[model samples]
Target: MGASKVIHAIYTDDDVLMSAVKKIKAEKHHIEEVFTPFPVHGLDKAMGLAPTRLAITAFIYGTIGLIVSIVMMNFIMIEDWPQDIGGKPSFSFIENMPAFVPIMFELTIFFAAHLMVITFYLRSRIWPFKDAENPDPRTTDDHFLMEIPIYNNNQLELENLLKETGAVEINIVEKDEAH
Candidate 1:
C-alpha cells in the first residue's frame, strides 16, 4: 500500500487504549495498527490478534541445540578420541553424559536466545540499518497510539467514534511514499 490516509489517536492510559480498541472493532472500523510504550494486557484479544509463535520457535531451537550437542559430544569423546587420561572410559557415552550436560545446556540457551531475537526482528520487519517506522515519538514514552485507516467517506464517522471512546487527541494524517 502507498500513501494511505490514516487517522491516529493518542491515549494517556492503557485502559483507555484498550477500551478504544474494543469500541473501534465493535463498530466495524479497520484498525491499521496500535502502538504502546509497553505491553498492555488484553490488547491482543481486543484486536483479535492470535498469540505470538515465538515460544514455539524458541522450543524448536532449544531442541535442535540439545540434539546437536549430544551427537557431537558422543561422536568426539566416544569414537573419535578413546582417551583414558583419568581412567575414564571413553566408550561409556551414557556414563559421560553428565559431564557433557553443561555444554549442552549452554548451547541450548545460546540457540534459543539468538533464534528468538532473529525471529522477532524478522516478524516485526526490523533489521540492521533499517529505519524504524514509529508514527509518534510519544508512543515510546507515556502514550498509546492507535492508527485506524479509513476511506475518505468514513472519516467523519471514525472521528466521532474515537471521540466517544475517550481518545485524548486525534489527527488525520497523510502518509507519503518513500520512493
Candidate 2:
C-alpha cells in the first residue's frame, strides 16, 4: 500500500504559527491539521471550524434525565409503595414530591454526568484503552506543529511558503509498517 504523504512544520510560538496559517490560507493552501502545546484563543475562528454544540446536546440530555428521573420516582413511590413508612403523606404527587427529591436529584446528576461523558467520548472519537494518534509529542510540550498535505507534489513551493511564514524547521514524514 502507498503511504500517505504529509509535511510537518515546527513552530516555537503560537502567534507566529497563527500568522503563518493566515498567510497560508491567503495563498489558498490546504492545512491538514494543527497541533499546539496549549489552546490558542480564536484559533478555531481563524481556522473556520464550526462552533461546538456539546453544551446544547448536554443540556438536552440532562433535561431528558431529569424528566425520566421524576417520572420513574413518582411511578415507583406512589403506585408501588403507597405505605407511609415515616408518617409522610403519599396519596398526592405534590406531597410525595419532597420524599422523591433525593432520588430525583441523584438520578439527574447521574444521568447528566454519565451521558455528558459518553457524548464527549463519542463526539471526540476517543474511548477507553484506545491508543490516540499524536502527530507530534512536542505539541504536548512547547512546540507547535502544522501539517499541510501537498496535493500536487510541490515540495519546493511549500518549502518557500513555510520559510516565508517563519517556520523554525520543516521536515518530511515517511511511514512504514513495523509488523
User: Judged by lDDT, which candidate is best?
Assistant: 1
Q: How many backbone clashes does candidate 1 have?
A: 0
lDDT of each: 0.87, 0.82
List pairs with backbone clashes in candidate 1: none
TM-score of each: 0.91, 0.84
- Candidate 1 positional error at 151, Å: 2.3
Clash count (model 2, backbone only): 0
Q: lDDT tens digits, residues 5-104, model 1?
A: 8889989999889988998999888787899999998988899988988899999999988888888888888888877858877877898878899999
Over all chains combined, what TM-score does candidate 2 have? 0.84
Give per-residue CA lDDT, model 2, range 10-124, as digits (tens).
9999999999998888888878779998999887877767899988877787788889988887777787777777887678778877767887778777888889999999988
Q: Per-residue lDDT for 86 in model 2?
A: 84
Give the Å error, residue 7, model 2.
1.2
